[model samples]
Target: MTPEEKYELFDRFCSNELSATEKETLTKLIRENESIAKELKLYQELNSHLDTRFTSEKEEEALENNLKAIGNSHFNRKATTKETKMIRMPAWAYAAAASVAIIFGVYFFGQSSPTYNDFANIPELSITERGNTEKNSKNAEYAFNSKDYAEAEKHLLILLSKDKNNTEYQFYYGLSLLEQDKYVATTRVFEKLYQGNSGYKYKALWFEALNQLKQKKYDQCAALLKNIPEDAEDYLRAQELLKKM
Candidate 1:
């Protein structure tokens, strides 16, 4: 119902003639809008004034009824004015509304999306390139390249146990953890790699950014991406991702 209809119900309530539905609607409006509650209080006081000041019961009743009708008429006029304002909205109006809604949805969902899968370009780890011919290193390489992250993480752990300072092993191990959604472990490994001065410094920053992206930490991701210099391998990709964000 319109505000006019609601005011009509409120007037009927003041006149001691509220139906069950009008009472419920009035109660709900009072709970929902403080303005309605204040207005209702004033309306009740006006009714009280009509009852107390008038000596003749019939005269009091007629005056109260007219006052209530005037209140109803005032709100009805406002409702009529509102009705006049609402013409048929165009198709483009709906399209514009949809576009606004889509933009709104993106402003929200974009905070969560354009994620790790959207930008991760993790290269296949090669144990032979670093001259580690150990069985576990070979296993880690094969498993990681084949996207078997669970097995890769297990084998990389064994390899890292023997050679703790091998940054290549650590970077790939971080990748394995990240691929398996081991976010905390991935960040730990990547943090060490990023902090150290090695071939993996910028690379570590890039992957850490991807790790942040996976967790929907766009600000952190952007921070890490910005640290990548133009000469860095992932610099172009990071800039592109920033634009999307």
Candidate 2:
């Protein structure tokens, strides 16, 4: 099978939804390709992390109830004949509960999501490209790319919690933190991403340089800018920043 096809199957396998034959085929594919095998390992690790981080049934129930309330607002209540049981909660209560639930869900879920924001749609880096195989990456990317920083933060955090070793997610999580103006945390994340050899390596360096520039650390900014690869995607930006530094 092709690499992408194998990746799709691998993801299904991770989700435990692949058919027996598909699983067998994936097993065969992994046997033949070392890169696929490595990807599978990373996917497995991320799945394990998710299982650990967001395993609360109560939180899940609250979120479900909130969603149900939001969708049921238009439904008319049926009068019961037995004892005339009355549903008394106002639509506003449902709305308020759902809002609270959504906030909790976003924060807890983001803390555990598998793809963080700092790396959301970073030019050349796909979650898969950066060794992140989380199922939530796309959703997180959508939220982040659309500038819904709050929603984006939720999924990204969840993803990162699942794959802390992934520099891409860490980078994106950092960017999300930065977007929210969490400068110190953003600096730390970009520092890690900048130091790594992943696709975000140069991008992180550029961001770190930008962060330094923002803080008036001109010498540090220039130093970081100096390290951005001449052929890196952000080369021009680095040069521009350097001139200003």
lDDT per residue as tens, model 1, 78-100: 99999978878899998998999
- lDDT of each model, Cα atoms only? 0.88, 0.72
Q: On residues 53-92, what C-alpha lDDT tens digit does candidate 2 reach at each position?
A: 6797679889899989976763434323323455567889
Instruction: Identify the leading candidate in terms of lDDT.
Output: 1
* Model 2 CA lDDT for position 143: 73
Candidate 2: misplaced stretches above 4 Å? 1-135
